[model samples]
Target: MESSKHKHYHVHDFDSRQFLENYFSDKSDMVFGDDTLKFVIDNLKQIFSEGHINGDILIDLSIGSFIHHLYSACEFFKNIIVLKVNNRCIMELKRWVDERTGAFYWGHTSTLLQEKEVNSDHFEDKEGHLRSAIQHVVKYDLDKENMTDPLVLPPADCVISDCLLDAISKDQDDYIRYLRKFSRLLKPGGHLIIIGCLDTTYFTVGKDKFHVFTFDEDFVRKALVGEGFIIDYCNVKKRTAVSDLIDYKAIMIIAAHKEK
Candidate 1:
């Protein structure tokens, strides 16, 4: 259970399964998967189709409990690593990946991917590909000095982080600091793909609230440039005001590469 007063500051007690049910459910997914998510998936498809995005290791930093964000990464990488913030999310993700009896159904992601001209058509085929591509699903902590310690993982050729920073960081300063930490996981010349909600203060699930650091496109681009990244692509999609999930101005998607 999360304290209603401090839910904004607590990360470990975040509900993984409830998040999946509220946001990533096949029913709820239709709202996002069709519109706002379209921009993100479209940009990914463009680079992949243009032969600009492909590599051995593609890392996704936590991405909360939802797995649909990595659906595009599966086609471009030989190995994909899904990093999580806690074991609860790990267990929830594993349940879906392992095809457990009561796992949250992921059919909607596959359905959306199929409509995008992705290489795979069959839902099982896409799931198999994602399952095969994912080599690791380890825990990550933005508060840590070294996000990963004791066990060293391979530096990624590409990293895809979706709104995890806003979820974990308590403020703009922490967000920038953790962004630098996440950048260290990439190899020189490696690509970083980010999808975030702009100007969000908080999002709720059930009765509990979680913090989302407020940021605009200029701040994100400026921060990444300061970290010595070359911006390849950046775009924002305005929310259609359909769901009451959160109050955010828009969805921002950015693709940048570290200097070699």
Candidate 2:
């Protein structure tokens, strides 16, 4: 597919609410629930449960307003700093954080996390905990050397990016460049956890077809290594559920740490 045919996320007006409803909602017919939501949640739970990724701060640079991935993260980090490339995503996230009306309901995701917990807490408590842990929701500029300039953030103990690279990057060089930026936000030895779709060209949300940078597992592994990261864990799940909304061969979760 020609890149020009697909819209860029930075130039496009993404319907954040519609995206949540389409994929993250509790609706029985959601397409990406099992392949994406469940896959990420389960891997995150196991990663955090292993006690290798806990720290004082975890920086989130994920796509969309989804918070399911952070349910397990709140238990491990005292603070979570969210960096968004667009205001739409920031507003959607703030609506949920501020407990405003019309915020996308994530109870279904919280429930999924609860089932994995040995001593499950109530949904309200889980939501409250995540909200309290989110320290800031700041805007970022990919073009800037300091993505979050004028608000110099302390080096985080861990950084989590979910599909943000693939969504924003135009090519392999852009992906590696963004990865370098994410690496700079972390302290040496700090872990970087990524959840990304593999071999995908585009994804649609409310009639907008957003370009997705296509890459394979070997490319990702090389990118991380070249950026001075030591891969600790990597998992890939082949696309199972059929859907016209997106074309992805697989989903990958990788846990790596900056070399000390």
> Backbone clashes per model, in order?
0, 0
Candidates' C-alpha lDDT: 0.76, 0.90
Candidate 2 lDDT tens digits, 1-260: 56678888766888888888877888878878887889999999898889999889999998888899999899899999999888999999999999999888988888788787777645459999999999999998888888888889999999999999999988899999999989999998999999999999998899888899999999999999999999999999999877788899999999999999
Q: Worst lDDT window (10 residues) for model 2?
A: 115-124
Which candidate wins on TM-score? 2
Model 1 regions lying over 4 Å from their true place? 1-6, 28-31, 118-124
lDDT of 1 by residue, 1-260 (tens): 22234365335477777776666666635455544445666766666566677899998885556777777778789998888877878898888788889888877666766776634435458887888888888886555677767668788999888888777676768888888989999998999888888988777676677777888899999999999999998878888756777777788888899999
For candidate 2, the lDDT comes to 0.90
Give the TM-score (vs. native) of candidate 1: 0.90
